[model samples]
Target chain A: MLNIIACFKWVVDEADVKIDAKSRALLMERVGYKISDYDRNAIEEAVRLQEQHGGNVVAATVGPSTAKQCLKDALSRGPERADFINDPSFVDLEPEQTAAILATAIKAKEEYDLIICGEGSSDLYAQQVGPALAERLGIPCATCVNKLTLAESKKEIIAERKLDDGMEVVSMPLPALVTVLPDINTPRIPTLKQVLGAAKKPVDNITLNDLGQTYKPCLQTTGILAATMERRRLKFGADEKNILVIIGALLKEGVIA
Target chain B: MNFNLTEEQELVRAGVREFCQKYVEPLAEKVDEEAYFPMETVKKLTEQEWTGIPYPAEYGGAGADYLTYIIVVEELSRACATTGFTLECHTSLASYPLYKFGTEEQKQKYLVPLCKGEMLGSFALTEPGAGTDAGAASTTAVLDGDEYVLNGSKMFISNSPVAGVFIIIAMTDKSKGTKGLSAFIVPGGTPGLKVGEHLNKMGIRGSVTAEVVMKDCRIPKENLLGNEGQGFKIAMMTLDGGRIGIAAQALGIAQAALDESIQYSKERVQFGKPISSFQAIQWMIANMATDVQAARFLTYHAAWCYDQGLPYSKEAAMAKLFASETAARQTNRAIQIHGGIGFIKGHKVERLYRDAKITEIYEGTSEVMRMVISGNLLR
Candidate 1:
């Protein structure tokens, strides 16, 4: 049976993030954290695979110590156990730093036949950690995977990558990495028994000291401001001439394309 | 002294909320409209061991406390009151009696499956002639050597159509009045046990209720729930626990009404601003929230008392009285907040309004609750 690891991130629930009108900074008071959206798809895919093919699914995540909450949530979604990398310093880690830390932590824990990740974190959508971690671990990686299947011999992973123009079919050898899109599958809401089972599942919480890894951010964000859209309150009568003018303006602005 | 939920309790809420939103809420309207019992969802609930929330793990239950049962009932009712009604009845009314009074063999035969979700249970204590006066049951059970022949009719029995196990109360001795009554374990398909057509209900339409007619229905002497003369006491004891479940159900309905009102107030625009900005709407919302919280505390406290093995009849009565009335009032105000739109059929508020009234009437009526509370205090 395949031994797979599903990676996840805990992100602020964006719905609760309010914008300070004057400072344009996010108001994070009373905010809650949830497993990153697409990361749930990654976990769900892992669970589905385990259900179809007898295997062990372990959920792994790297975040602040508070991110321990993600372990129960992931395990509830059908994983057998969880491996949590908790470090306060990882809160603002750049994608490369996150990948390095996760690779180190995962390697220290156990060998896995496959590693699944969301295409990117919901907050940053960096699309870097999966491929970067794969590179560090020297395993082939696939991104934007919409459909995936394991070979009968379990030596290869066949993935359908969703691209801008068309879908690309690619196969990576066993012990590979694949970052999935949200469309990979709709994550199931864990049933009551599954949730209770999660409480009993083992969670291995690893710290930076446990991993014995050191990472430094290579990219820095100076600031972030909320984007505001201003709608033009244009009033036009039911006339052909006005409509045509509106269409022309839309065409010039590339809004119609 | 701790008001905060334990991590396990919180997990129960989170897990149930997610499940109800996906499985129960979507079917609420369709069930109400078509008057269809949701067997699939019920099966799913059984699979999750929710049917046995407050029972023991050895009996194939979740081994959860009464408070956990309250939480499960509250959350389930919040999404669909009918489902809440059915679940609470099955847990508190049908299964409780067997669990509390049945012998080890009886527990093994009935309570185990009831808690395991393998079989659904119903309490057939209510009769046309005996609504609040449960001791007035005309149903007679004659001792016939090895079997007791049951003959009577019961009205307004919840889960009668779907339940495989029934906790039936019948008179074993007429001179004993309430004391002569006895409860029995009658499994479905027992000859002479007939389930009548489903009665159309104002609310909780999805939970099947019907008349159960027993014409010479015979069961082995071993099927007796408790001693022959202990039926009224058993019924009263069962209703004491049953009231808390109904209270939780009412609290859930009231909470849903308040929640809908809050959401509606924000989205509904009036006089160039949201209705929520109006002081009048704000006042309604505030009052509704207070009532819901009060009902919740009452329900939870009663459930807690039961969990601690304390005398909780008065508390349960108080909780049911307050919570059921709160539901009725809150649903009315919820409808008022929605105005004409709320009165329209198929509207969530309208359904809630209709559903709220039954809480005041069933299990124990508000008047019965008052009597129970006052009588206990006077005693």
Candidate 2:
């Protein structure tokens, strides 16, 4: 049976973030967290694969302790179990750091035939974790995959990659990793029974200490400011003369050139 | 007094909200305008296992708590009150009595299908002359051989026209007054059982309501629910739980109205700025926000009581009374906030205003709710 692992992230719901008018700072005091948008597709794809081919799907994540809520959410989406690698200092880690931590955690876990991840996290679109983690584990990796088909032997997979110009098809053997685009699948909303059942699913809480790793930051983020746009609150009368004047102004401003 | 929903309950709420946004909200206007039953959406709900959320897994239910069921109703009603009421009637009024009082055989035969959403269920108690005075029901069920023959006519029975099974209340011995009442399970398509044409209503139009007529309709003797004299008690307890669902429905309607008003006031400019800047509109919004929150607490608290296995008759009555009245009052304010636009056809607030009125009158009227609350205290 194929044992699959789906990697996910917990990010602040961007819809709930508020912008301060003067400081251009994001207000996150009351903002809630959700499973990163594309990661939902990753988890869903893993579950779908398991349903089609008899196997176990385990969801894995590395984040701060606050991200514990996401374990239940991932499990409710049909995963058989969850692996949470939590450390308060893991918040806002660089993509390379995240990949490093994930590699360590996966090495400590059981064997896996395949691994799936989102093309990019909702918070950071770096698109580096999947390839970096694959390099760490010395596994073949494909990025931007929108479709996947398992070989008859269940030891190989054919993937369709979405590119800017066209789609590319590639085949990889078992024990490979793929970063999936959102178009891969529409995630199913969990029924109430599934939500309740998530409570009974086993979750492994692994701390950095358990991995026997000392954290060192290779990169640091200084600040993030909201982009502000200025609107020209121009109004003109509906009369013919004013309309002509407005047209002249628009022409002078090069808006109608 | 931990005032937080469990993690599972929260997840259920989120899932239901997402479902309603995609499936329920898109069809709401058409449902209201055409007075068409949303059989498609109902089927989707059944597929989600929402038809029997609070029942046990062995019985084909979701095995969730009553509070989780209440959350589902609230979120569904937020998108479409008619759809919400349809589910509430099926789960709270029809399926609940069976789960609470049915024999093991009865549950296996009827409750299992109801929980699985294989068949829709209905409860019939009110007659033309009965209204709140349920003891005045003149329907009779006389034993004959291996069956009981039911003769009666029920009015304003929700889900009657489309129901697959029904819980009928009738007198087994009229000389005993309310004590003579008995409840029976009558499957659809039974001989001599007839359902009248659907009734057109002001609000919640998509939910079908009709009259049920029985002329010597005979059900198996095993179809009797509970004991013969226990029908009144069964109905009263069932309604006590059903009121929590209705209250949740009312809270959903009120929340929808407030949501519309808040969004409309912010975008609708008048004079020099948005009407929300005016003190009058702001005050209305403030009152609406407060009232909706209050109703939510009452409704959720009642559901919590039920889940805790506590006596919540008074709590349920209070919730139904307050939430229903709050919905009616807030929807009116919501219309006023929208000016003439709210009165126009196709506007959400207009439909919500109409939908809010029924919450005050159904299950139990505001008068009956007050009587129930006061009676609990006086006794």
Candidate 3:
């Protein structure tokens, strides 16, 4: 049986975030957390693989104390259990530090055949954690994987990576990592029974001290500003001349070539 | 006095909210427009094991508390009130009585399948002659040897068209009045049980409502719920719990109306600025928001009381009264905020306005809710 680890991130629900009218600063006071968008795909894929291959799927995440709220949700999606490595200091963790923590936690597990991650977190689309964790673990890593098939007896995984130009097919040995795209699969909405069942699933809460680590951030996040676009308010009559002028304005604004 | 929902409760709400957005919200318009039951969505709900969220797992339920079940109903109603009412009627009106008063044999035979969603359940209490005055019901059940033969016609029965089992109340002793009422578990397809055609309704149209006629319908004596004279008490207690569900449903309808109004106000521009900038529109929205929040607290508190095993008959009545009125008022304001568009067909607010009215009418009327509340207080 193949054992899989799905790594997810608890990010702020962007829908709930409000932008300041004058300063364009993000208002996060009332914001709630959700599993990062693509991370849901990663978890679903892991669970699907486990269901098909007859194995166990454990979900893992690195975040602050509030991130504990995401564990039940993650578990409800189909994980057998979860590993939450939480620290208040993890609030501002960069990609590398996050990857390091994940790698350390995975090493503590008895055995795992595959590790899956989203292409990137929803808040910051820095696609580095999955590959970095794989590098730290010294395993082959695939990025932008939209499809995956496990050949359990052969100890290999066949994956389809979605690239800008075309799809790339690759076969990698077991114990490898793949960061999946959102389109990999439509995540199943956890059923009421599943939500209730999640309460019985085991969760291992490992503090920073439990991992025997001292961490320093090499990268820091500055203030986040909302992206605002000012309307031009250019009025044009419904005529060929005005349409031509609109096209010229669009070209001048670099909106169209 | 913890106002916050428990962790599992919050998770249930979020999960149900997500489920509603994906499955229920998409078909809401079609369900209303065609006045058709969305059986596909019902099957999905059964698949999700949400038909019986509050019951014990031994009976094939999710084993969550009443608050979590309320949350599920609220979220489903927020998307489609019809679907929400369908579940509420099945669980609260039908399955609840059996769970509360049925014999062990009756539970295993009936409640299990209802909880598992293997068979839909319905309650038949209202009749042509009985509305608020349930003691005036003319239906009769005469015990003959090993069976009780039933003869009656129930009116405005929700889920009768699709239900596999029915909790039917009939007069076993006319001299005893309300005490004479008796409840029985009659499986669908029982001899002489006939479900009439679907009734045309202005609100919650997608929920199947029909006439259930029992012409010499016979069920085993073992199917009697509780004692022979306990039907009225069982029904009243069941409705006491069912009021919480209806209150939650009202809260959902109001919340949906508020959401639609807020979104529309921000988008619809007048005087070169969004109408939300105007004090008149802002006042309406503020009132709607306040009312919706208050209704939610009342509804949730009632559900919490039930979960705590506290006496919540009065609380449920109060919540049903306040929340249903709030729903009616907020939906009206929502339509006012939407202006002409809200009156047009296919608009969510229009459908919500139609759906909100029934919350004040069914389960218990607002006037009845007041009577219940005062009756408790004066006692």
Candidate 4:
């Protein structure tokens, strides 16, 4: 019986984020947050493994108190319980800081056979948290895992890692950490019943004070600028000659290739 | 008063909106083009337990409030009015009455599975001869010992062909007029109960509609819903709730039209400038925006009144009437903004245009709505 924990982040929905052209800044006033896309796969895999084997799946996240909304969103995806580390300081934690907090929460929360995380968050794509978390917990960890299955004896997990060269298979004993790729599984949307059931699921809140980690930033100095797209503002009359010119330009540009 | 949605309500909207965008929106065009019932989406919704929102937890419901129900309807209708129509029929028309008026045994046998989405529920009230005059139902229900034998035919029965359970209105004593009307819980495919072919419609085609013919359709005495003479009151009360559903559907349709129009105005260029810059287009867009907002206020207010246990029949009627008319007008302008493309087939604006018209016709007609409002005020 495996007790699994899926670590996720509530990140701004990029679709709703607007870029300020003049200031080169990202405007987040109208943006809403969602469970990071890759984290969805991690959650699905945890739930899937639990369904296949008899166990419990707990979803854990680090974010502000407003992120309590994520509790229902994640639990609806089939997790039995949730551990939320909600603190104002959690808003902009570096990868290592995030890893330390998650490790502390996991250690304090439950005894787990496996832990899962996305390769990286949608916002940063730093890809550092999963390995750093494993190091913090002193567990063997695998990254870029696209496919995973438990051995028949349920002693260890066999994971298929997706690398640039090709697929690599790795096996490790219990109490391991695996960072999942998006292709690992297509996450299922919570049905009406699942959404309703989420309301009944138990959620525990862990504070920054509970983690007992002194907040210090090892990574310094960051700057962000919005990338702007330049498009030609060419216009032509809707005549046969203009139509031919448009087709010729398209052909020359190999757009019609 | 606190007008902002609660945190939970906001979350429900965000979750349902995401679901609709990912799953419901893509298939909406195909459902309209093929006039398909969207069984897959329906199955998914049922499996997810969305079919039972606003019901109690003990009876297989989500235990969500009525406001959540409105949000679900609004979001679904924004994607496809047919889906909204189908869910409304199930929630308000079919299952709601059973939940409100059914005996404990009836609730156990029917309401539980209905909330669990085991089978689609349908309501049959409109007859060939009776549309607005629900009290004038000619369908007869005769008490024959252990069973009540029904002989009647209903027209424009939504979900008739696909329904697993039905709430049928029949008259036990014609002399008493509307007071004589009674409701029955008739299981679908019962002996002598025939569901006719799917009726082709101009809008909301994705929801199946058909005629229901009952020829000596016999149900046990226990199947009779509410008291013998309370059918008219029950049907009216059911419709009072249903008007909110229809109004929410109309709000969704209008909101979609307004959204499409705004996007189109920004993208569509003419005379070396986007059409949105023109004051003529701006005026139309402005009207549409205001109308959509006003309708939302009316619809949400009615839903709130219902939830608060306030007398909301007049408010619901006004909301339905205004929202449906606004939807018709907004869709018309949405097409104008899209120019020739909006009129052409395969356009979302075109589909919404067709879908918008039915909201005014069904549940309670715009004319009936006015009568309800005026009657309430005059009294």
Every model's DockQ: 0.45, 0.76, 0.82, 0.44
lDDT of 1 by residue, B1-379 (tens): 9898765667678778878988999999988888889989889888767898888877777777899889989999999999998899999999899889989899888999998888889999999999888878999999999999999999999999999999999999999899999989999989999999999999988999999999999999999988989888888899999999999999999999998999999999999899999999999999999999999999999999998999999999999999999999999999999999999998999999988899999888999999999999898
lDDT of 3 by residue, A55-139 (tens): 9999999999877889999999999999999998899688999999998888976378899999999999899999999999999
Fraction of native contacts under 8 Å reproduced by each candidate? 0.41, 0.78, 0.93, 0.56
Real contacts retained, model 1: 0.41
TM-score of each: 0.94, 0.95, 0.97, 0.92
Q: Can you write out model 1's per-residue Cα lDDT over A125-197, one digit (the tens) per residue? A: 9899999999999999999999999987889999999999999999889999999999999887665567667
| TM-score of candidate 3 on Cα atoms, chains taken together | 0.97
TM-score of chain A, all candidates = 0.91, 0.89, 0.92, 0.87
Residues B233-275 of candidate 2 have per-residue lDDT tens digits of 8889889999999999999999999999999999999997999
Q: List the residue pairs that clash in candidate 2.
A: none
Most DockQ-accurate candidate: 3
Q: Is candidate 1 or candidate 3 better by lDDT?
A: 3
Give lDDT tens digits, candidate 4, residues B1-379.
7889865676677767877888799999988998889888888778656787888888888888887888889889999999888888899999899989999899889999888888899999999999999888999999999999999999999988899999999999999999999999999989999999898899998889999999989999999999998888889999999999999999999999999999999999999899999999999999999999999999999999988989999999999999999999999999999999999999999999999999999888999999999999998
lDDT of 4 at B283: 98
Which sequence of candidate numbers ranks them by TM-score, best first? 3, 2, 1, 4
CAPRI category for model 1: acceptable
Ranking by lDDT: 2, 3, 4, 1
Quote fnat for model 3: 0.93
